[model samples]
Target chain A: MAEYVRLKPEPGRTVSDQLYQLGLEFPCGGCSACGGCRVRLVDGEIPITEGMREALREDELAAGWRLACQADAAVPVTLDIEQWSARILTDNTSVAFEPGEGFGAVMDLGTTTLVVELVDLATGDIRGVLAGLNPQGRHGSDVMSRIEFDLREPGVLCEHIRGALGAMLAEVAQGREVKEVLLCGNTAMHHLFCGESVEPLSHVPFSSPALGARTFAGSELGWKAEVVTFLPCVGGFVGSDLLAGLVACGMAESAEVMALMDLGTNGEIALGGRDGILCASTAAGPAFEGGRIRMGMRAGDGAIDRVEATEADAMRCHVLGGGEARGICGSGLVDAAAVGLALGMIAVSGRLNNAPLRLDGAVQLSQADIRELQLAKGAIAAGLEILRRQLPVEPDVVRTIHLAGAFGNYVRVESARRIGLLPSWKAPVAPVGNSAVRGARLLLLNPSRREAMIEAALRRTRHVDLGGDAEFQEAFIENMRFMPPGR
Target chain B: MADLETLRQAIIDGDAKTAGAVAREAVAAEMDALTVIQQYMVPAMDEVGRRYECEEFFVPELLLSARAMKAALEPIRPLLAASGAKPAGKVVIGTVKGDLHDIGKNLVASLLEGGGFEVIDLGADVSPQKFIDAVQSTGANIVALSALLTVTMPSIKMTIEALKAAGVRDKVKVMVGGAPLTQQFADQVGADAYSENATAAVTAARRLVAAG
Candidate 1:
């Protein structure tokens, strides 16, 4: 096994000389898209890699540099990728709604990101879209971490979250005439919003403040709107996000079977039929959002949105914004894993093939990247399998799979199917862009719709706690193999 | 007469049936219960604790052996009580408020009990005042707090402060453990000990008691 250590550059020490042991050229001499050349900062700084030069700013490079491609164990290096480099798509559209026109705003409070959209109640036409980092993320990135933070500060941490949401609402409204506000988020996020503690949501027999949709005056949250509605939660972990996704996909109205999935920080999936909706939330972590992986980014400019194994052992990438590839995002990650598996570039256990396959000119899929992707894909696949077992129908019985969220919007359905991330079904795959936002929009548009959402939230049943479910763990391990079952 | 040495070896080996029979034989022959517990049971559990710290044994094995030791001790409880034998210490342990996760707490309690500490497990969602009240009523030497949620961690600190306010903080050592807890955090919160797992909790408690 090849061992690489990332070193930080110091005054006396040169990075190029130290990285000589790794046997890579300074500029990595490989495809600039091959982000393998990036090195982690262990202690000192090294010169920036070509990928980092474009991805990072002058101040970031001046602080210290490390190649995203050629990391060496010779010294410690600090990581210096520009935060903006992680973003794939930039929305320049401004909020444009007239005040007192009965416009409403809907918000999806994700763990990593917060997205707010303004809609015209009469036509359901989107007026404006805005997104920002969830300020609560500074406390911790995952739900478990945030819960820990809440325990320490009591209501203090929750106040920070409310403030962030309030600011975003004010921004989205932008002096527009908003009559109602609708919000959709996970159960934990909802609990925090209502000033209810989330500690109960982390344990077994998980409980929430309320399992159904709730309504309060917008004034209650100090919003300018007349009424504010929160989409109902199904269980402690499976919240209104899944329900809203289901509703937006028109799953409730359809007699045909369907699965609604919101693949974000947590992979919340709801599979239902005319019988009823069964839901589960898997702790996929933030790997898809670029938390755990090396050189991973959100779907933004300079990110690798797609990857494929070329005729030779080389990898081809479709970069976002037509720039030098900086890092891979969630959709691109799925593509890389699926392609790697198909080409035998990665083993069922998620080990990269010993033979080096070029990503760009220089970077290659290391063992760590493979392991990270395995963990991510495994959690998702396991949740799907667990939900399948609890459902009354077979996998084939499901007629449609509606993928929601920005990550889902960018992923190619065939790549997802090829990776066994989703079950093999004959149903056509449809992308419902930000269904949480859409459902929130519905609540914003009509007071009756808000009430219906609350009622729908109350009716849904949450199935097995993914963390405590032994079968989920078994499925996770089985899915980690990455090969078709029985192979 | 095989001396205390031979009997202690039996207990350490976790041969509960043999240890119980030998203990009975020794008592019938006029041996003291306190001596059997101190010279035999405590030593055995101490070895178990050491083995656990070294990773030679995991949770299931430690739990099973503790069970065996408990089985042997059960029949001699009355005898030990009559002889006025005291436990090493008494502890009140539970998961903090708003957190209903208790597996970690239960495991630590079992290990503490096995280590000859009288453990009173209050279960999950225990309020800070409840911990203080338990310490006051039970006259426990230590309060073990567990919280799996970061959100609930403040409850651990609150319980400790509550104990301090009740004038019982000096009477008991505050020990906090959980997945999210670190030694630095425990120190910052003014806790005397922090352990990552149940076995470490036993070791930390023993060290705290010995130091006190």
Candidate 2:
């Protein structure tokens, strides 16, 4: 167990402000939407705020659980705030990266996050890692918003991403000879960073204008790397990131039918094996990223990233960066939905039992929140069904579900199954940790790996367009319910 | 004789099998097909439409009720044709260029059929010229255009302008719809009418058809 610290609240500000001013890590960014920072009252009782009422269950509210963002400690209430821990997906399970001359790096350009990792070229050792929230988030949370911005003004996002990478490069390089950098992102990010016009991607049938690999010198980004090579996009919204994931998992050559699902703001599903692969991407929206939820945020310090319910219906939580609960982040939202289902608080139609699922009368899941989850999960479930139907493989025959992306890596499989986020199946889940980044790293370390990915993108895989499929439309409406469509 | 009350109740309950069987029985029993429709089937859909307008009935509920009504109407279709029963109106509908989504378009078509109109669904990804050709061929009184994407919504105005250029603008009523379309946008596009949802589309179609 981590040590709990007792701290006095500064005059009148909420507990969240006190922590923020203290320069402590609170992932909620002090947004009331994510009760990410919560400090429990160990001594005197503090009246719960309205926002807190929705986040905490009945027992939690009674037991002195209070939102650090919502509850202001007028009198220094002895607070029990646990220290933080981050469950980052740092496991490099892909074919080990062998070293080279001086050094190299791999970057995962996520819509919401930017992660840069510096590696020792000779020994294949990860020297240092830097992660920063994607600076382009000021425009919007999802890729679609970024696309709109691109349409309004060309080359704006390209500058933003290029500059951000440049800053990151400066920090990691430290005047060392960083020979090459491998980058992988979704179709939109891939286009923006490479200075490609996003005219084609802004509309439907998202055809990438310049999907081929491109190399940019360090001078281009005003950084230290000699060259940065972007991975090629496969098709449609299925970009180089997915190709990277496919490379990391080594999915193309397997004899047995397998599936890879990357759960994120957009859900990309692939079903294939020795037979040609079929991939599709659905706009699952930013529900998993804390977008469009009453109480949602990215997984950060003080965020409720895991949740459980007792036989007596009391709610318990596992917060990321384990301190007092700040707010429910993406992983926590999935857990709450699962736990809510278990307690019969969320109905099959995704309707809440009555009001929101109240955790200590401080945290609640509103009816609208359940609907948003339904729409988001429904799109993914439908997309998967479409891919399976187009292919010869049955769900039972697909022996493994390779869950990719940071959301897929950290999310509990049982929770995913409970919410129908992942298909209801008995197949073993292989948590391929941030397969895109891993794939990028693999490509950076080895030339054969790069060749394999390019071959798969050009020859072995077919991108299935489900936009107008009747079966997919029917499945989408049916999957909108909490229950599986077939049932 | 088959009971009209049973026919109406089947439609309201969304039971297609029961609705079809009862409708077939009524037609075989020498009941006037138009009489059965005016008295029971139409009234049943009217109730569903009312509930839908009031938000008591949602999309799924509205769809189920429409399906049941169609089941009953299918048995009466040939009989009404023999009797020279006129459709309430003729409508041609399609989602505009670059917008392949069909949910809203399909809903409006089903609701139009429930409202006693003939709808020729052009499916999705339809162009302005295609809409013009359809209007010229079908001699439709109303043209329903849908576009879900803000970028694609301009196609609706193009279709309307195409009608004017073809000198058939006065012949048909233009109804523009989709999620991104607002009344102001619809008016700016020179559409005769705008609807927020499929249920409202039914009402707007009826108003346009009646005005003529």
- Leading candidate by TM-score: 2
Alpha-carbon runs more than 4 Å astray in model 1: A1-101, A212-214, A355-358, A361-364, A485-487, B1-212
The estimated TM-scores of all candidates read: 0.60, 0.80
- C-alpha positional error of residue B132 in candidate 2 after TM-score superposition, expressed in Å: 1.0
Q: In candidate 1, how many Å is residue A128 off?
A: 1.9
* A226-306: candidate 1 lDDT, tens digit per residue: 777777777858777776676566565556678888778888888876467778887777776666767777665577778
DockQ (Cα-based) for each candidate:
0.11, 0.35
Over the stretch B1-212, how does candidate 1's per-residue lDDT look in tens digits? 42556556665555667766666676777667777777677778778778666544444345555665776577667787787778878899998876766656777887787778889999888888898889889999899999876666777888888888889999999899997789999999999999987878988998999998
Model 2, A281-385: lDDT tens per residue?
Answer: 888988887778887777776677778887778778776654666567777888898888888877765757666676532556777777778778888998988
Best by DockQ: 2
Worst 10 residues of 1 chain B by lDDT: B55-64
Task: List candidate 2 segments past 4 Å from native.
Answer: A1-96, A300-309, A313-328, A339-346, A352-363, A456-458, A484-487, B1-14, B35-62, B210-212
